[model samples]
Target chain A: MVSIRDVAKAAGVSTATVARVLNGGTPVSPDRTERVLRAVQELDYVSNGVAASLSRGRTGLLGLLVSDIANPFTAQVARGLEDEAVRHGYQVLIASSDFDSEREAQVLASFARRTVDAVALLSSSGVGEGVARLIRNGIPTVFVDRRPPDLGEIPLVRTDSLSAAREAVRYLIDLGHTDLGMISGPAGMPTAAQRLAGFREACATAGLVVRPKCVREGFLGTQGGYTAMCEVLDLPVRPTAVFSFNNVLAIGALEAVRERDVRIPADLSLVTFDDTDLFPFVDPPITAIEQPAYDIGAEAGKLLFARIDGAETAGTDVVLPTRFHVRGSCDRPGR
Target chain B: MVSIRDVAKAAGVSTATVARVLNGGTPVSPDRTERVLRAVQELDYVSNGVAASLSRGRTGLLGLLVSDIANPFTAQVARGLEDEAVRHGYQVLIASSDFDSEREAQVLASFARRTVDAVALLSSSGVGEGVARLIRNGIPTVFVDRRPPDLGEIPLVRTDSLSAAREAVRYLIDLGHTDLGMISGPAGMPTAAQRLAGFREACATAGLVVRPKCVREGFLGTQGGYTAMCEVLDLPVRPTAVFSFNNVLAIGALEAVRERDVRIPADLSLVTFDDTDLFPFVDPPITAIEQPAYDIGAEAGKLLFARIDGAETAGTDVVLPTRFHVRGSCDRPGR
Candidate 1:
């Protein structure tokens, strides 16, 4: 094990100077702080807080890891978790991965070191390594929103994005539209893959064939959605209806369409996943699949508390239902 | 400090067994885990992660505290900070305070214990005790958006909300409006107080008296804004124009007016602080005072990195400028 003395020697500083830097904020010279940091990295010193905290037990804190805390979807779910935790006296520490796997691993390791009671994760790039550590450490963990396709034997509480997306496509087909364009999420993410799969399955069941050009994958961001929409629009014999995977994507797609002088649901009906306040207020009032982010958080909290209470439990996969918010944005083709 | 041995003795476990539990996941029995947790709580043991981390140096991490990460205003700023820090290879750990001062204190303490590089705060309920502790401990701390009105010697980077709000009100007044109503945020928050003061100052300068009934204080939440808007609407001789303090409030207030079947700008001119995508997409795109949330975060990150690089600096109050986004929502009021 790397010790304070070793780090001190490597950094060419006194053990106390190293401690001052490590303890955070005691006005150590920047040069000494830099040297100590380098030494710690070289030594690969594991944090002792988790070990120390385990002696104290259940920090009454739950660590939440997601790609972007600023993402409205993530934020809403967090709000639900934060509000519910108050009932059982748990505070949440949320960190953003910014879609980087390495960052996620570092944060997960930090959470474990903090000895949080549990973890609620919305996996960015398959939090595989971090999940492995959490499980090995016996810290209860639950996946939220997006997780790996399968966790072998781990608890997950998330919206059924695939089923909801399928239902959305079916609704559009029933409204008498065959030619449909889809704005898909990035390929690697399970949410994106599932939604695309559902869209294909729905088209297959309806005996309708979608042109390859009509299905475009994007970074699942605003600009990605807009560019994809433009591509779909330029396609010869463009689809009369479009299915955007989520709210942000829908917003961008809608903007692209708005720039063109097209009447919504008359020229092109639009539907997307993820409902938010802005959806209903948009000029045409977009129809969307509500992910029920709050409910997912509430359920994740429930599962976590059960584990913290030492419940002899199975690794349950709690799949919550989604609802389609019908609005003026979708209608019979050429309405 | 309460040692692991003490915890083990209290839990009727051996020192090695206690070590196994603290080190995490080597699999102690559920009964033993329960007993250990109880013992730890009774002993009030804090983990030694900070000591371990300090022995190492610069965690390559920064801590950010905000009232609500879900709040669009807060989230956008976080996005900027997160985006900027990646340039310097620093990751951010953002904790939602949920607008509670107590939670802010606890999170701050944990950050210090974990030995993060520095902290950026978007205060809720004035980061009183926590700021004191951070300063006393020599942690480089900077304030973003909202801080205590008087911190004497702390760096603060925020949008100039007061001047912006005042300018917005003056614009409305100049647009042929004698009477006006306002949906103000809770008075306790410095942001709220500043905006309110700006409005009052503007009214005084215009030689206009604010009717007490036209002013309402909301929780700065959707429902609160809705209720306040309704009250203002029902007042006898209602003001022709309304100024909402921020985006969320504007959303709720807009819904209230939408239900009333009144023509915007003509029946009731509306202006607000905080421009969002929804504002421009709505019917009669909103007139808004755009607070530069991202710029504020970017500047905060810059100030923090400077402090981390060992710049001997005095407390800086960096106030960024706001822009008025004029849209069709405001017109010469009539009918």
Candidate 2:
């Protein structure tokens, strides 16, 4: 309960001097700054961040809500966003929604309660009603990775998942994969729908009919991928090649392939999205479409700062490019 | 600029009703709550989180600072901690220090300025001076994974790295390997020091002369591990087996080994710490001492909440057990 007045009195300095020292940036004599710090420590004066931020009209804190922090793609995006946040002298508070819209709403509410200066929401799932609340509260928000239709005018920074998926599917088709299967993300996620659309588009362009049984939707996790792959393998007419929505799914599919003693590329071709470091080292070096995850995050941060700074970027959508790494995981269907 | 009074007036309700609707917990008539929310939206009444928190004397926020969020171990730990935080109606803010003590200090200072309810620091490097400032300001903190000597009387939740390292080395020795090289973490990290000590202790117990050239320090990253492994490989007499301090380093060392066309188990045996899911599927599946990363994080969260709730658990260290998974990575080395 020690106040700034006590510290100012003990330091023999004015309240302004203590505030200047604590908040930094202002020019203060080194001697006075040292004395103020010493007094703060000796008197155990804890500055009320709430009171200070209230008066200043800025908290210097950004709230980031990611779908899953454990996912490498999201994690890298977070790192990129944090790097930008730190560069701008802002502290970011991160919370994971775990792909649940309810949890996303709760997290947004919590962020609001904390009064973060602005928020960046990264979710493949649909944007929830909490977003409307945040917008109504006049908090600046930027969507990263996925921008649902409902979020009509919110600024977004993301890679073009549809085109990337089409490119990956085209690559598989070029490998003579007419009987191709796909493991997609959750049903409601925009990214999942876009990727699925791309897959069908590519198949149609090649004059090939994608069998209904060959397409499966999985949760955005390895376990989900595994179960989906198992279902595909259990089919009477197995696919000669598979394109997974993301790296985690690809890995789970790989596990199922390995478990069933199916040789990669030789028995079944494979391609996945979001290439990670492990892709290059895996037994048959996975063929992958690498999204500019870090760049997307950084751009999201940039757009968010612009919004917070009162820029007119409400409808801005900064789409970065994706790279396809042609490795040994893809080949002409041998079966 | 819209205030609670404006919202209440618009909704035909009291300011207390608006506050209750916004804050939750208090059961009010559904109609009244709906009206208040509509008025808030219509008026764009953003709640002053700082002012509310100052009056209530609690922010319901916990800050977590980890060495590296990109690392899978730390990422999982974060997920675990956040799970516990959400379960207890608290939100977590995460920051990565990137193993720099200076950055760690900056993060801590920023956390203090944000006035988080409590903090948990997970660093393998060293804790810096900002800790003292936080402690002086009456912020409760608990150390996770590594507790430096300077952090006396601070509670810790970590696995017994020394015993785990000793066990790993002994297991390698049991496979009849005499010359064992080690890739350790940073020079001054407590966990690094303990693991190195355990390596040396095991060698001493086996009556083997420890060669200085056989031990190398890595920066707790893949690139550092690669460089260190390359250096070890360039030695005049290569060891029969190698122990990497963590999975990241082991993967880096594996890359170096693969680049040189060195066969595993036949040419050299490998053991590592912190078993990740990738370890089981890698070629010649690695032998590893798996630290209970998630459990450690959960325990740390439990301890942090205990401190926040006014429990007397300071000076306590919660030591979790490490599981040894012996896979195909080790054997009688035929060098």
Candidate 3:
């Protein structure tokens, strides 16, 4: 329990000078600063973060909530946010919601209780009540990759999923694939809903009927994709091309295809969303809609910090464009 | 700013009852608990974590340091730790060391300043001084994946990388491949040292010559792997088979091989360490030594919690076994 007084005594400096040096406040002479640091180190005097936070009314902590930390896309976003937070001299407290709205709400409540300086959400479930709670607590928040409806003005950084999905589907249609299939994410998630809408728009524009049997809802996991892909394969009139709206789902669908000995592109052209590093190593690689996951996170982090610093950043919606990477996964339909 | 008194009055309960409910202390009646929760929600009451932590001397926060969070193996470990922490009513604050000892030290100091209940380290760099600081501060710690020597029995939960590497190399030898190349991590890292030792032991047992020109060092990254593999390939007498002691390095080596139009398992056999989800999808589906990353994390988390709960777990070293998954990445070296 060594205190600032002990550090000051060891350094032969005043308590005020020690506080200034430790808190990164007004600068002290270089020689004094060196002495203070060395003495603090030798005495092992750790400033009580709790006490400092209580007095300053700031925790120097940022809260980040993600649906799944194990997901590569989510992990990249977290990495970006963490890097940015470190640059701003803040540490991030991360909690996973596991795609459950209740869990998300509980985590948000915990963040509120912790009095985190700001919060960022990549929630896959409904965040209406949880966000309202944050706002009620006067906590600055930013949305990443998911947007809540009617939330007045919370800054958000997200990918243009609709346009990306539309372009991917149109590519398949251009390759003379009149019948198309899709493995969509959970219906309620905003990203999923947008991708699904994009799929419909692409089919309608091409004068192609999107068979209900060909469209299956996936749980944004590999198993969900496997099940949905199997159902699509079992259809009476199978689709010539299929789109899996997420990388994990695409992986599962690929497994399903490989298990059934269905050759990619040759037998059924495939397209996927959210290109990750592993895409290139996969057999035949994958043609994917690449979302700027890192950028989205970095932007959200910047926006949250701006709000925390008392900037009027309400209603700032930053939508980054996606890239269409044409790889070895898709080709024209064959006999 | 909503005080306990206000919530107690609104719920028609005593302030003690409100505090008990909010702090998850002695349980009150279910009816009263329900009323207190409703009143809390209606009034948007948030307990001050900093003030409560100051009084209680526990922050309910666990600190985790990893080399890289974006790596899938690291992410899985983090996910396991987070899940275990959540089950025990604690949250995790994760920081990446990025393989720099200075950064690792800084993060540990911050964790101490914040008074985290416990810490888990997956540090790639020398953590001697950082760990000493933690010990001096009386903070419970568990080592995951990497262990620092002469630490006087700090609990460590890690994979048996040495034996796993030996087995993987043995499999390559049994396939009649004598000349073998390796892409090893930085020399000082414990995991890399152990893996390199295992490779040598296997080669020695097989009466194979260990060529200095064939063994290249990598930085635990894809680019590092690529550079090392290129050097190996440029050798006057290239080895028939190669072992990458890490997954990212193997990815880089694979890329280099692909660029040269050299077919895997035909022109050159390959084996890798750390089997992740993406391994199965990779071209040729790499044969790998699968470390139980998630289990290591979960076990370390359990050990850390036990230490935090005042259990006598000093010097407990838990070494989880690794599994060798034989995939399509390896075969007898052929003309």
Off by over 4 Å in 3: A5-17, A24-42, B5-17, B24-42
Q: Model 2, range B1-335, lDDT digits (tens) per residue?
A: 67788999999999999999987999999999999989987876777777787788877788899878989889988988888998898888898887777788888886676468888888755666788777767788888888778877889998999989998898888888889999988888888889988988898899877778889998878999998899888898999889998988988898899898888889889999888766766777888999888888899889988888889887999999999999988999785
Write down the lDDT of every candidate, Cα atoms only.
0.80, 0.85, 0.87
Best by lDDT: 3
Q: Please give the distance, in angstroms, between residue A115's alpha carbon in candidate 3 and its true position after superposition.
A: 3.6
Residues B1-335, candidate 3: write the lDDT tens digits: 78778899999999989989987859789999999999998987888788788878888889999988888888888888988998898888888887777888889888777558899988888777778888788888888888866774888888888888989999999999999999999988888999999999999999999899999998877899999999998887889899998998988898889887878888899999988777887888889888788888888889988988889888888988888999998999784
For candidate 1, write residues A186-266 as lDDT tens digits.
888889999999898888999999999999887756888888888888777779999998888887887788787667878
Task: Tell me the lDDT of model 3 at A225.
Answer: 92
- In terms of docking quality, model 1 is incorrect
lDDT of 2 by residue, A1-335 (tens): 68889999999999999999987999999999999999987886767777777788877788998878888898889888888888898878888888777888888876665478889988655766778778767788888888778887988888888988998999889878899899988888788888999999999999999999899998878999999999998899899998899988887888898899888879888899888776776778888999888888888889888887788888898999999999888889886
lDDT of 1 at A242: 91
Report candidate 3's fraction of native contacts. Answer: 0.80
Model 2 Cα shift for residue B310 (angstroms) = 1.4
User: Between which residue pairs do clashes occur in model 3?
Assistant: B153-B315
Candidate 1 local lDDT, residue A195: 94
The candidate, 2 or 3, that scores higher on DockQ is: 3
Ranking by TM-score: 3, 2, 1
Predicted structure 2: clash tally: 0
Descending-lDDT candidate ranking = 3, 2, 1
Question: Which of the CAPRI classes, incorrect, acceptable, medium or high, describes model 2?
Answer: medium
Question: Which ten residues in a row are the worst by lDDT in model 3 chain A?
Answer: A146-155
